[model samples]
Target: MKAIREARGISLRRLAKDIGRDPGFLSRVEDDKQGAGPGTLHLYASYLDVPLAAITHKEIPRDQERPGSPHGDDADPPPDGDQGSC
Candidate 1:
């Protein structure tokens, strides 16, 4: 999520404001501490101009991360990095 957001050049503050969330809370999500809900995922997908599946498909934990895999599709999260349940 963070990678896509960064690739699109979306800033933490900007994305948070656009989605009606706090930047700090969003940050927690990125660090894998908080979880982003489906609603929030929709907001992020809409804001980022990407499909929800694109973000939700493969979020796995670092421990479960597959070798040579391109991305992490482990869990839902809040903001900060929204990996999408915070």
Candidate 2:
């Protein structure tokens, strides 16, 4: 998590503000002392310019060249054929 934040040049305070959370709380989450709920993780991913799956499912192997891979050029689309923009 810290790596992801640093990769995007985001500070803890700024990320907390963007996600409507407290810096200390965010810190705990990053330190793995506390867990962020799915909703909070989603917000963090959005604010940090990361994919939700990256944080939520860390064990999953990513194939960057695949269309839906987080590291790929294509942004993931919603299921159910929805065309929602990220």
Candidate 3:
């Protein structure tokens, strides 16, 4: 999500302002530290000009993974250099 947003030249501040959310909260969501509800997901999809399925599909598969599994999608954090500063 963060990658797509950055690629589209959308800033965290601007996205939050447009979606009526706090930048910090949205940042957490982007970092996968928080889970976005359906409403929030819809807002993001609408603002980003993406289909809701694009976002929901990624989330659904992750949620179905067994807890404490040794292997799972995104079980590892991205490399430090890959993250852009907000």
- Which candidate number maximizes TM-score? 3
Q: Tell me the tens digit of each residue's lDDT in model 1 across 1-86.
A: 66567666789999999999898887877666788998888998788777777666455334334444455454434457546555
Position 52, candidate 1: lDDT: 77
- Whole-model lDDT per candidate: 0.72, 0.73, 0.76
lDDT of 3 by residue, 1-86 (tens): 77567756889999999999899999998888998898888999899887777565544334334444345654667778899978
Looking at model 2, the pairs that clash are none
Query: Which 10 consecutive residues of model 1 have the lowest summed lDDT?
Result: 60-69
TM-score of 1: 0.62
Candidate 2, residues 1-86: lDDT per residue as tens digits? 76567655789998888789999998998888899898888898787666786766544324313455566558665677587658
For model 1, what is the C-alpha lDDT against the true structure?
0.72
Off by over 4 Å in 2: 57-86
Error at 66, model 1, angstroms: 20
How many residue pairs clash per model?
25, 0, 0
| Model 3 regions more than 4 Å off | 57-86
